[model samples]
Target: MPTELPMFPLGTVLFPGEALPLQVFEPRYLTMVDHCLAQPDRLRFGVVLIARGHEVGGGDDRTGVGTIARITSCRPGGGARLLIGSVGEQRIRVDEWLPDDPYPRAVVTEWPDEPSDVSDAAAGELTDRLAEFADLFARFSVRQGRPALPVPVWADLPGTDGDRGFALARSLPIGAIDRLRVLSAPGPGDRVLVLCDALADVVAALRFRLADPGGAE
Candidate 1:
């Protein structure tokens, strides 16, 4: 069933279980936040990555896949502004884009979660890949003179394969496009596939950096 959902087209992608901090300065988004807060049933909005143009004046095109963002906190900021923190709850696919009545809206369909897609083998592989990727990133940071970059420990990650997958992917040094690919993936297994491919290239670069004698080892 197609449902109309309030959308916030942004320059970034929101992954399920991710926390995003937003600054509400624009009148449209300010009003949007007010409306969301007024609704007791759900203080949520949809966030999609802008395909073209900017997030400021609203001419930007956006991708169909997005995540449901639940408002966690809303604090008063400098005059007419709000500092908001939201956590992604679920994924949704835009069936159609409706007119921007003050704010953008979409006809959306619920994106189903298929945990079974994340097989035992895939989960194990994802965990291993995350560890290697994290290690490489930490080393790469050290080479760049940022010695304080924390190395990710596998045990510290979320217990579920799905949560761990999003957490690791979010921490990657890859570009926004690759991150969207992971966010829009149909299931956890598919997200891992895309992430693994990107991770391979990143890890290779990190290895090359560490190999150079001039670089910090």
Candidate 2:
């Protein structure tokens, strides 16, 4: 069934199973939050990247597609600060947008699922690479004393047999358009390839940062 949902367009696109933190202070968004809390289903909203348009108001080309996100925790700010932790659930295709309230509202339908087909060899390679990336991320977090971020709870995330490999590929440090392409990929294998491409850039960026004087180890 098609449903009306409140949309939160961001500078970045979030993937399912990824965590996104936001500072919500706008009055419309505050109302949206209140609505979600009061709803019986505790329905979540979509987090989408604002593509080729204005961010604060309406944009010229905003993708009707987005990932569903759940509000896990929220910290109220004295005046306009609202700290929120959200996790992406699934993909949705927006049918039509209604208006731009404090936040945007839209009528949407659930996007069709795109499962992946990964070969054993490719899967294995993905596993090793993800493990390396995960380790580096963990180390960097520890070295920098940054708050620990949550990884997926599912098994086989960075391994040969699990969907985790695909997840990690989509979630790594990548640009919004690349992330959107992964999200829009027709199948899992293609998505994984997109992830691999992003992984390459991630490696290059990490190396550059690490080599820099201001970059952490």
Best by lDDT: 1
Tens digits of per-residue lDDT for model 1, 1-217: 7777778999998888889999999898888888889977658899999989999989898998889999999999989999999998888899999889878888888786565366667656656876787787776776677864564554477767667668877676777788888887777678778877887777787788788876664
Quote each prediction's TM-score: 0.85, 0.73
Candidate 2: segments with Cα more than 4 A from true spot: 124-166, 204-217
Give the per-residue lDDT digits (tens) of candidate 2, residues 1-217: 7988888888778877788888887677877888887865865998778888755545546886788999898888678768888898878888888868656888888775566676666655656666666666665666667964654422445553224643664556677878888787766677666666666677667666656667774
TM-score of decoy 1: 0.85
